[model samples]
Target: MVRIVFVALANLLILVRYLLGLPFRLLASRHRPTHVRFRLAGDPPYRERRRAPLRLRLGGSSLEPATVSSLESFQEALGLLAKDPRVKGILLELEGLEIGSAKKDALVKLLTDFRAAGKRVVAWAVSTDSVGYQVMCAADEVLLAPAGRLELVGYAAEATALGEGLARVGIQAHFVRRGAYKTAPELFTHSHVSDIQRQTLEAFLDERYAELVEAISRGRKRSPEEVRALIDAGPYSAQRAVSAGLVDAMCSEADLPARLEPPRPEEKAKAPAESEAEAEAEESLEPMDTWLAALPWAPVKWRPVRRKPRLGLVVLSGMIVPGKGSGGPVGPTTAGADALVKAVRAAGRDKRAKALVLYINSPGGSALASELILEAVQRVARKKPVIAYVDQVCASGGYMAALGAKEIWTAPHAIIGSIGVFAGKFEASGLLERLGVRRTIIARGENAGIFSVSRGFTPHERESLEAEVEETYQAFLGHVAKARGRTKEEIHERAEGRVYSGTRAMTAGLVDRLGGFEDACRHALNLAKVPTEKFELMTYGGGARRRSLLQLLLSMSSTHLYALCPTCWGLAGFKAGEHFDG
Candidate 1:
């Protein structure tokens, strides 16, 4: 009896702890604490009542695909700084961050905006890679770490060639893409860079890198010639950096606080709260950032700041899938085909929507789902001016969905078009056979083999699949031709299972214009003749709630119910940032 009581007590305690910790865990998740710290080491309190300086510290690891979450954190920090009245300026430390030139440009752009808001930005670096220095160049004052090394090597890129790797694994890759520029499969087929892939990738990087250099030079008050000379000079010491005017001063991290100025006398020597309730109140009194709060669903905070007329921008991101869910097998959360259709219909039904902009950023999935989304877009287009914006990448079924719009807009670097269909089964029969795992039969017909894992496809099965691909491809071409008012032949010529950049798409009549999401919205507004001051901009993803608690709990209860699609699987990991990492 005593043993049973002890066991019951242990179970009860476990349950209580779990229940009590739930809310705190959620709160902690909502409050993403930055691991990057700033030390106010040895600064003297200000004597002045006003114009007292504040010491800010910036520290973070290299932001990249691996640590991509930091980008969201940085964005939140920017928003906080934008509205913080107490902040006098930003202290940027660029040494620790390992980012590419392109990413640096984006970070620099944010810093420039901060500076433009009447706040000074002082950056210090112990060592600066050629690309990393681009960010430091944007600061009001760039400082050097006394003992830091600065490597000024120019731009270059490296890729992991997979042909040999795959060969060792006994996998033969066949490349069937049409465009020479469509080099996606080359990774598995070629041991070295093809002249085409090398030239294209290099040319593309050169253009973007040059643009960044020019932008940085102007921001740093240096001529392009000076910047170019520095890049060509290569590795330099901190002293050399100071002499070259690349940095304002050389100092150690310990001396940073002494150089900073706080805001006012009251801001310094602030009293600590004595009571826990007071501490709690101080924390709760902090202004919550709506953007940060809405990051889970890619939230947008658009105010009528200037009463700009807003076109209906319906973003159909992610793979096209059936039902009333979001996300599919791969990529970001997407509206279900049915839900998207409803949204499109509602926008058309509302006179206030004025015009519609269908923004697509998907890798394409599910033939039936794509067709349904296409139908929805077509339904909307019939009533009002509809435009399609392809950002980052839109291919295969993505291109199929874009056919619903009257005009298509894409970025110069955007990957658009892949008018094709592909459906293949992964055959594991040979491996299973080698492993002596023979299968016992229990199928109704030969067609059952269509989804079997036991064997490779027969020649007849290949023909049937090819026929299906061809049928889907032709249907895709028909939609493009009809929407763009082009001849069937014209679309057929461009729609041979190929991908093209937005600019090339425009030249080949695949896309009507070369522009970004904003451009697409502007076009829709113009075509609809809706003044920019009329409508309030609204978005879908962030506000749409996930499944109810009961459903989630029930889902957790069933371990065998694995997600068959990637879209549904990635929804739980949905982040609030633009999906444009090339």
Candidate 2:
């Protein structure tokens, strides 16, 4: 009882601290209306505060999370740039960093947009490596310290195979997937990339890399071939880089900022303490509003302020499972049929919700679960527009769920399709024999031991399971054909368990359009007949923490959700000590 009391008190204190600290933290973290920073070497004069541009420093390793904060900061800085006419230029310093290529792509786009609008983007690097130089290449003024070096290296990808490694330990992996390109489990099944997968991956990398080269060449005013050659022969000194069109000039490290914008004594003024404190407080406020909230100070709100039609976004991420489940970071497995059915029914009953958008980011799993979700989608589509948006890889069961949508929007790079099904069984009779283990079962049916891994299935059992798999495959094809407005023969050619990227999928008639979430939302509003100018996006859940935590708790305790995927892969690296022969 004492221990329990102590624990409760500690929890209470933590809760209080978090509650109180959040507000202040938010305020402190809020973007200042006017950003002020001192140069590395000197202080600014009082009057210069009015002329100073918002000062920001960028850092990160991949756009994932650690870098997401930096991106948010960049957005805030951009907002300041837009509002404050006094804001002159942005100094984008690229230093030693490990940000992901995806994040780099987004940042490049954002910076490009800013530069296009006549904002100065000056990038400086102390010692430029390949990763750092990639970002520098996007800057209007790529500056290198006279003595600094720039290294450009080619791209490479590495994979660790778990198949043979686990085999020696007596563990057996049974994989059941439909698409030839569903390579998620290849980590466990194959030691190296198959020829087909290799070709696809290479093609994708080539396209992205080429885009990078072109963007850099345009930004630096260099020929694409010349820029490519410079990157190819890298590890060049600052002077050499400037001569090769890789940089605008090589200047002393201390003199670059002064050249960008000479520090004026009048630009260094600070705001009053009281006003600064109040501004900070306002910045710390929570982001609680909806669409208008996202754009708080707009001259005119996109939709009406008082009333707007709400859009229901139903996200189905990860592997599909049965029963009920939430989606996202360590959430429930694929939403069970029942959960999807219930959600769709709720959406239909809610008159305020104008339309529904199904956001999917799954590799597909559990055919039965997919069927349940499909049923819900079908029911929802009959009443209102149900649009499907694919992010990342949505294959096999993922495609199954999308079949009921009136239309589908896939990201340009999104991986979609994989209308195939395979049922797998492990035969461990050899391992059992080696261990001197014998099994005897007495049952009325010859296929009674169908689930036993120690023995191969009887012909009757094999035929039954194969028939079921084929039936499921046919159902998948039929649904896709109807949804896509394609005939059976046309879909059959593309639906034989083959995966296609968003671009390829569009050509194959597997997807209606190539777009992102924003496009899907607009399409949904248009289809639902909600005046495009007056609809609201209504997210179903709370903040990510509450939503994700609740989902994890629910998934672990829910007996109905039994997905073989995420479950098997997560445990693959661990020693289950289960011996088998495949």
Candidate 3:
């Protein structure tokens, strides 16, 4: 009886709010803007942008009066412009855009589609790096501020080693890794790069450089050789870029409106009455936020309903770890095993979901967590087809989780493979001794003190730890072999913690196809035998919700036997924990 009354009161409040806002909503709808301007700046949550408002939103509160400018919102605004007859074109203000190469490619393709629909896209940027410039290149006309610069320097990878620095502070790192190319431990155990590590880094840089050259070549209508030469000669000033045909022209932000709307050939002799309205409409572009705010009824807009089959998209990003992961927009992100397992199981039980796409963007982490996620993925695969889509860096345990999927798709330049394991801890006995701090130990088992930072591992303990890591390594190889329908020996040939680019991984049988997220979704639908027209893609467990500082600290404190790729993590601009103050 109480619950019923609460529900009734909630509905009453919603009705009252709707009634009060109806008049304003109607007025705003009548005065809808003629053109939309989208600002593509900063890194947001979503990977792709839509051109218009969604006919249907998949999740989240409908009544919450809040708006966050994300990739999806930008896409929706562009989509609206594409469909609205009144909307003549879109202005893409691309400034300081920080996104991965795969996302850049996706955005470029989106612009291409928009242009194909007879809409013009004018991109304006102040200052941007090579990655941002690549996305800007997709627009019909690229504009830059007079003083802005393009940092088009070629790609380079840097790795930091702390062995010598740790030794100076009377500390040492004792670690064991299974593969020669597994250079993650070197950051602690070696002072400099190993032959294998140097080789691996060089190979990665070469692949990424080649990808950048190709993208710029296609965008600028230049040969690959020419693109490489131009990049080598960069960073370019705005005027220099225009002179070299890298950018179309130099224009200030205030002058963009005049540039966008030159005297139209057919409108030169328009009636005086028409010119006034046209001039007013073209005076300023309306932001998507203002347009959305005007239409409070937009959320409840009516649409035809259909009982279509759904594709479940589960995104596993950041460092894969045990337990519910921590952090969000305020700190480092983690992919918790418990959250992912529950999400995958939920998708498996959902009757409407006919297929699943496990979108992976991680460098891997805890071995146990990876195993748990892979187990859940395999369970879902039995009931519905599951495909893995590698977005950027999927290595070590990240690849381990991917093995559970029936097939894997990867971006051409995505970092894949790294089939290996490593485990160890910092030994601070010397540091303690140097500081004249004495400690006593008490233990109940032979290996009870194996993980104690106060002392190094005993010979017996070291032997035991190595055996355990070796067993895990063998199991990893076995899983990969079983998933690919190959023998352990054949898989072992490529299982030395060595990473591969997406194209090379396909040739190595590590992944089934070279494609992006959309391709993976389509393949999932095809495998499930669901019609594309009658299918809807539903996402699961990709939230980056903030956690308390205490929770974040706790999450980072716990240690595990890792299947992580430190090299990849470092290259991605993450810093691993180190002893002593910086």
Candidate 4:
């Protein structure tokens, strides 16, 4: 009882800590009016807007307690700047903008728009690596902290095969794939990649690498040879990057504001030491916000939320399955056909939905489920514009679903395109014989027991399964060729069940645009022809909601959820362990 009491108290303390630290607005805003104001103050989107020519800090990650930054929040922030009339130029302050290439692509598009309006977009990095450097390259003037370093190593991918581990476990993975280059099974069946797999991987890498080089060349305003040379001698100090023409200037982050602004008639550049000391003195006087001051212990209000409509976002972010979908919040997610199709059809039917963006992040599963999802998405496309955004690892069935979209947008480093199908059965007769266990099965149908683990497939059964796999593969090829407006030869040349990087996939005609979430959102919005930018985005419940301990405790009693899985219960009762071969 005493131990339990202590545990409860600890939980209470943790809940208190989190609630106190929440980002809810605690203080009332000052009611005042100022003339000739640019509303680009460093404030959250929820805060009331003011003047124009916004200044937003982009390099830092989202506020803590939020582990990763959501692309939605970033988009909304950038979208506000893109739409607001008071905002002309945006000064993007970069601290450590560690985001994937998909998010980066979105930033590039937003930044490009900012420039197209004749507004200056300046990027200044305090500390950065290649990912941060990429964003800086998009800015009109790339500024780096004096002590910071910039690393620009090219792309790389590595995979491991676990055939030996399975062999040691006395498990046989018998797989039959249609394509010669279908290498998914090889990860479990081969100790090393096959020669054909190596060739395909090399081709993927070459295409992506060339694209990377070209992007860097264009961003840095350097020749391909110059960018390639820089990549070879990567990880340069700020001074080295400036000397190599990879970045525009090298200055301490403290002096960045003046750098962002033009020199007044009497203004002159000062030394780093004078600037740093002055910056420190000025920063010390800045008052701490009331929320941060009381963060150690404070009460928070959970207010009701208001919803408005903008674009429809349907996310399919897990393995495809063929029943009631098992995903969202906590998950070993299974993207079910029934649930996914419903989401698609709902988006299509919604009159308020100006456009639909299908965000895919799956490696693919269940051919039947994938096909159903594809058909549903095609229906939505017929009504309104649909854009597919492959965040990462869209392969096989995932790729099939993506093709249903009018245009495919992917991050440069995002993985896409795996056109192959296979079937497999585990044979455990050897293990059974070693364990001195006798099992027998009797079936009337010819192929009823084809999947029985007590025996391997007969030659006739093997031929039949192979033929079925081949038919699926051919169907995949035909659909891809037709949708992409490419010949079978052209599609098959890149198929071979191989995954390609986003840029490489675009080159192979497997994907349309090399961009990120922002790009896809904008594309769908543009296709819908949204007259004004003051629109709200609504996201479907295809993701997990991070709940605070307090919220969980408060809702725990009200929440009623239970799973009645009879097969799992029976298996557990039998003490099957890893020895359940049937």
Candidate 5:
């Protein structure tokens, strides 16, 4: 009751603040002109610069949040620019842009659409690596600062093995995996990559490298061979990049306006007095976000009186863990079973929501947790259509949850598959002896201490664990076969804990189609038989709510089998033991 009262009071305070600021907001909006006019200062003395091209900073700090609001707002701004006649063109200022391959492809498609609308799209950057350069390539014209460099280095998949280090410290990992390719346990059990691990990493790298070459070839109007050659001889200077046709020109931010809009012949002949007047009339460039927020209706929150069929979006990101996982704007996030089940059920119960889109960005986690979420998703699918959209990494347990969806749509570069299971525990008996620490345990059952960290697993215990892992793996295969409408044998060929790119997954019958979030949204609408022109998008479960420290500790202490992919975690930029260390 106290908590509810506090929440109500907080909301009341927010309402009061908004009401108090309304008058000033209205006044500011009324004073700011919708459009500005510029005089050429010659024969055409008064030229209307009604909609000076808008400037947008593509990456950097704006994309730091791993939230739906950030992505949704960016997409909304682009939609506004595409539809608004005042937005003649857009200048992209790119910096510190780092994103996954799937997201990069989605962004490239948005930029491509902007260009297709017959509006000029120019991108400027100081220095950038492969990710930023790939995004910049989407622009019609790519500009680089005079002293900047393009570090167009190739892709690499690296893994760190701590088996030897653990051995030296008198610690050992006892694990049982269903498939040879299920290599997550190798991080703690083996000193180096296994034969299958090497093959998997090499194949994955080859696919990504090919995709990069194709993207650059299409963007820069170069052949695949030419793009490959350029990539091989990368780290080019600004002038050299232009000479090599990788960049349009060596330019600065100040010179961007001239490139976007050429000066008129009459403007070159302007008198000092006329030039000053024209300069005063010219409107200065504003940040895209600032312009969006300054719009008259931006501050207002309105709801439609009439109800309409809506597409429900539920995001499942980060590692899939048991219980209710914790996260916020800061710190790491996890896909908790308890939280997701509740969200899915809520979406299912919403009368206005005609279809559901499961946006998954997980690399899989706890087997039981994944199963619980999958059951919830399947329950919802029975009532309405469910479309799973793979963002970047969706492997193992993540893919298991995706099976509940009626259809799976993935970005071309998304990682998918890995239908396998593994379970293990670390033994520190040797370490305890080395430290001269004696410990005693009394268990009622033979296998009661099976998961104890004090001792390693016995032969009988190992056999029992292997049987359980095999059973889980078989169940995973069965689920995939049923979802994909394929025989168990057919699905098994593509299973064995192996992951594939989105394109390959489609070919392997693991995914239904290759597309991005917007495409998935359209498909959901189509499946729901809702009119594409008018429909509502109701998103749920995207917020990363904070959890108490005690809850987090309890969640972390629990033991269970995991249907996870360490390689996928590595691709997501996490080291093997980082999550536990925190």
Candidate 6:
């Protein structure tokens, strides 16, 4: 009887405790704590036992793909923290972060922003890879699990070749290229890396290695030589990384909360007669980022800066194809000539858009389409600095479009240049003949049957076609020479259809700067005489919506025969930033 009565009293006490905590939840949600906890980690949604419904996402997860709305929501949350004054410091928790270079840049920018707001940033990770360490470098302090792995090993690239296998299977790729080093067609033309491709790859690897060393050095405040030595002996354990000065300390996750800043004194005294429970609830409320969101005003003093309208950011991603529709699944997401031209001209005419940035990620397509867009870009450059940012795959016709920009800035691994031309059609004469099928051609002109797949090119016809392609090649060279401030002869030396990595390309005089989109923006703003604070980035090429699959397929009917690099067309199988590591 005594035990039962005691249990009843305990249940009543539990109910009273829960009821008393109800008001503290609101205080926790609305008030900004002195030390903000930056939950910078995200788990794959699939890992959860009872999967969360889509609506359960407060805004969206960074683990998901970067859609427009998700990106905006992330920026909004970040802005709230940047503008919050009660946030004196931050404790970053990085469980796992998978991101590409562009996203990494954005995260680094966020860290910089929070720091600029006078918040001290600290980070803790269970494990670290090259990417993690890169981001952690932005933090004022970095702590890692004692047993965690620190993967600081350098970069590597590998290429695949399938030419000889195709030939043995009775398929032949009879193609012509203007550049001797254009590696796009090499996979199907040669079983191994050709001498020129090897040369290109070696130079590229050197560039990437150097970039990694420099980045690590800058982050750790170590000399370049020291960083190189450390990276050469990398993939360190957390303890070793700490001993090597790569990390601040080896710490367990539980210790993170204890190390945060002590509460700062309030500017104003609280009202008299406050209950002890209320005071305890307020003090124990912990958050890494400011909870300034949804509040009418900040908890501390802050100024609201209006969004600037200055720089025009025009994205010209995907393949360079003709017509107004995007490409199909079997094809590529095309940058339509009509759409690109419109975007460029619009940026040029917009009075507020003082500078322009052409962010290109394309494996070149239609030569004619590239030329059309190039003309529009050149006009934009005439009015303002058109900084072309080569994201990854910028080759052949893509290079042509980049030439129009006042200066070209390539990402560390950007593939640029292919100042060459290639165009041909496949013939199935042998297969048809072996099957005892014959094709009869009804033609009037001398070149009427030139495009017929039933037969291969005749001797005279082949010679004539070669001459035509040669003329196109010369035209390409002339345009490049004029745009790059080089003579035709000088351009020819580097013209033999060789694609260059950004670092190697700079040495080859193909790109002006080896940096990313941020660098491009800064250069554009500088050239246009615009201050960074006064100007804002306004997107230009987002005027059109993505077309349906049916629309893309139907639009192909409007395309006509034109000069384009077939090697580049096949490279659609290769992702952006993939290079022949040869």
In model 1, the runs with Cα more than 4 Å from the true position are: 1-139, 143-203, 220-311, 319-339, 440-448, 492-498, 513-519, 541-582
Please provide, for model 1 over 1-582, each residue's C-alpha lDDT reduced to its tens digit, 9 standing for 90 to 100: 665667667667766666665565556545432212221111111111111122343786433321223333455566565665445665666534543332454566667787787777777666766555666778787778899867765555454456666555444343233334434445546787677555644654565457556865886678888887876775678888778776788877666644554225564445654443433433311222322332333223332224345466666765555677632243244446677777777677766567887777665656667888889888888889998876455676777788889888876655666565544543445556667788855667655555455554556655665566556656766787887788778887776555566667788888888754445666788888877533445443321223343443232221111111222122112111211111
Indicate which candidate wins on TM-score.
3
In model 4, pairs of residues that clash are 38-51, 38-52, 39-51, 39-52, 40-54, 52-86, 53-87, 59-95, 329-544
Clashes of each: 18, 16, 9, 9, 0, 6
Off by over 4 Å in 6: 1-31, 37-88, 92-119, 124-129, 143-153, 217-289, 293-308, 325-332, 349-352, 382-385, 391-393, 411-413, 429-444, 501-509, 512-532, 543-582
Top model number, lDDT: 3
lDDT of 3 by residue, 400-427 (tens): 9999999999988788989999888888
Looking at model 4, residue 23 earns an lDDT score of 41
By lDDT, rank the candidates, best first: 3, 5, 6, 4, 2, 1
**Tens digits of lDDT, candidate 4, 1-582:** 666667667667777767655543333222111101111112222212221113554696545431123444444445444543434444555554544455556666667776776666667666665555666677788877788777667655454465677677666666777666566667657877578656655665575457567767878888988878888887688898889888788877456545554445433367768766745543311112321232333333322132234677777866676665543455245567787887788778778878988888776767777888899999899999999987566887888888899998887767777687877666667777888888887888777777677777878778777887777778888879988999878888888676677777888888888765655677788898874344556555344223333432222111111111111111111110111110
- Superposition TM-score, candidate 5 onto the true structure: 0.80
Runs in model 4 with CA error above 4 Å? 1-102, 112-127, 140-149, 218-223, 236-281, 284-310, 324-334, 381-385, 389-393, 406-416, 428-448, 452-455, 477-534, 544-582
Q: Give one digit per residue, the lDDT tens place, for model 2 in 114-193.
A: 76766776777677555456667777778888888776544433334566764654444444444464454455566555
Candidate 2, residue 112: the lDDT equals 81
lDDT of 5 by residue, 1-582 (tens): 666667667667767767776676667654332221111011110111111112444677532221223344545556766665656767766665556776677667767887788766777788877776777889888889998988876776666677889889988877888777788778778987677777777776787678778888988999999998998887799998999999999987666555666658999689989977765544344456444444544544333344456778777887787777766655446778898898899889987788998888887888989999999999999998899988678899999999999999988778888888988877888899999998777888777778787887767778778888888888888989999999989988888888898888989989999876767877887887887655567766544444454544344222358898868755644211122110
Q: Can you list the residue pairs that collide in candidate 3?
A: 49-75, 50-75, 51-75, 51-78, 51-79, 51-80, 52-76, 52-79, 52-80
Model 4 CA lDDT for position 266: 38
Between candidates 1 and 3, the one scoring higher on lDDT is 3
For model 1, the local distance difference test gives 0.57
lDDT, model 3, position 127? 82
**After superposing candidate 3, which stretches have Cα over 4 Å from the reference?**
1-36, 44-88, 116-119, 264-281, 287-302, 442-444, 542-559, 570-582
